[model samples]
Target: MSPSLKAATAVGVLLLATACGSSNGSGSDASGLNPPDLKAQEKLGKTEGEVNLIAWAGYVEDGANNPDVDWVSDFEKETGCQVNTKTAASSDEMVSLMKTGQYDAVSASGDASLRLIASGDAAPVNTDLTPNYADVFEGLKNKDWNTVNDVAYGVPHGRGANLLMYNTEKVKPAPTSWSAVFDKGSEYKGKVTAYDSPIYIADAALYLMATQPDLGIKNPYALDRKQFDASVALLKEQNANIGEYWSDYLKEISAFKSGDSVVGTTWQVIVNAAKAEKAPVEAVLPEEGATGWSDTWMLSAKAEHPNCAYKWMDWIISPEVNAQVAEYFGEAPSNARSCELTADKDHCATYHASDEAYWKNVHYWTTPISQCIDGRTDTQCVPYAEWVQAWTGIKG
Candidate 1:
């Protein structure tokens, strides 16, 4: 799936195994999060005969998408839990399907995670029950998007960082920070490009978090009016130099290849695609960091097959399985151990799979809401709808 264009998904009714319990293991405490009063599955029980799942189109392929890309078949054979999959094409559909409460688990993106949590459609995951949780990258564990009230809501699946990609020969003095595209963007004039989603506002917010500390912007996703305005203002200024806004990799690849976009934000996949086409392009996680994308496996709060759901969660994140999913999906594996098992020995290195230090500052994209995701309670933050309106005006 092209995470950039990901929006909503479809549904499938699923039966679940029963299990219950409270969990004490929450990865990190976000400042202002307060999760719903739901408990995670405590222990494994007898597997239900069947398990229903909702996922991104390519995420749960049982060889129907392709013959060689079957992860579910092995899982079914080993666990004895029949796997039924419904692929979602958008986050809106994913949320709607999850809310139906007919499914056991879902592979949700960051944009839909909080909605699931707040709506109580998702349950906190007992990391202790999922042994594979131990190998998950520290960068993906506990944070504003998937964690709340000191409780981990799900298992991180995969990730991709938005990077600063520029044409090698055209842009002199290689940039190490985002300032190359913001403060100094005039140097490139109308040749600059950026993602076109309202979420891209977080990119400008992230740059300000480093360069304009006075704005008190801690989390790029948690912007109060002042911080939001500052971020929007920055984007408005940057708009002066923006040649075009892009929402897909091909548009960006073509722009970079034609020298129409010399420097801007991009994903590793796009850079690789450009390089293969012989484009002189290089991408980096700038010193100030970047906004990226990720997916998490979360259980249904009303899961009928809780045991099977929990087992599926653990199974999907296992090192071998994680490696397969990561490689097949073209994203960095969340399981640090998965790096060692990839068929392409350099896959981990190429995707920075285990590079905690490199990913330290990368902020995965999260949906912005009124409740401060940063944990602030004193002020109301800008919601996503406002962000969309503001983004339109900035681009206009």
Candidate 2:
């Protein structure tokens, strides 16, 4: 989708969230906790045998490339702790599955981590416990989402933005402003698409940076009452232009296939899957900047295999594992050493691992709250709390 169109639609339709509060991989609502006691879990290190993990689709795979790629196997071998995993399609699912208190760790996106922290479903990560913590880049370290009131909940993993991917054949000059999708000029009206998540409200915030600079929105996830109201108004206007707001990865691919969408907000994985199918597509990091999420490995507040979780964090962030995962996933690696280890070190370069400028403007996902966009500081802005309620009302 064009940046403007995506931004405009993002403002309108992104906040449709429905979370299932189930525990484990099972569909049962096991345990309920209002606020997770991370301290209690911190003290329960490596006491349990089987570790349950809730994560995204590709974050944990079927162990295709390496037998050891399945983190569960490697953890068992090293710490004698068994591993169990349940895949979640969205952050809402992660929250629901974690409610049962069956999973020891969860891979939460910025949008979900705050809810997890608030509910006391997840625990603060003890950096000292994981040896690999030292290798983590400061750039990705300690954000408003994972850290609340100075305590961190998880270790940083992989990161990327919700960039625009398009078929070069359709548009000659690349799209810089979010207007490509928002303006909905006669050219690509019904053919456009966007993400159907509430968290995407930030994309709208991003576009407003250029169109409505008077609001002074630095972070899309962060907003105050007046600013938030402006953003919602902008979104309501963009909603009229949207054809289909996408949630599933495959659905986005199919939209591109039918030529129903010429441009839209997409991830590296979606682009990779399309390329694998020989689809005509191209991804661009728009000039007005972008909004994205970084997946983190956080220990559960009720974790039984703390040692195993720590080990897995260290092992995965290692140069070798980072390179393998990045190459296979088609996203940039957070580890600097991964570039040196990869046979085709150029992949890291192409992904812009070394460029400080590119990432300087990229806003990592963070849930907006009453206090701040990331809920880290007290400085005021439109909090996501209001956005959620407004979005909830809209969906209802």
What's the TM-score of each model vs. the native? 0.86, 0.81
CA lDDT of every candidate: 0.77, 0.63
Per-residue lDDT, model 2, residue 207, is 82
lDDT, candidate 1, 287-340, per-residue tens: 887777778899999888888888899989999989878776667998988988
TM-score of 1: 0.86
Task: List candidate 2 segments past 4 Å from native.
Answer: 1-47, 62-71, 184-186, 374-396
Error of 2 at 265 (Å): 0.7
Q: Which numbered prediction scores highest in TM-score against the true structure?
A: 1
The TM-score of predicted model 2 comes to 0.81
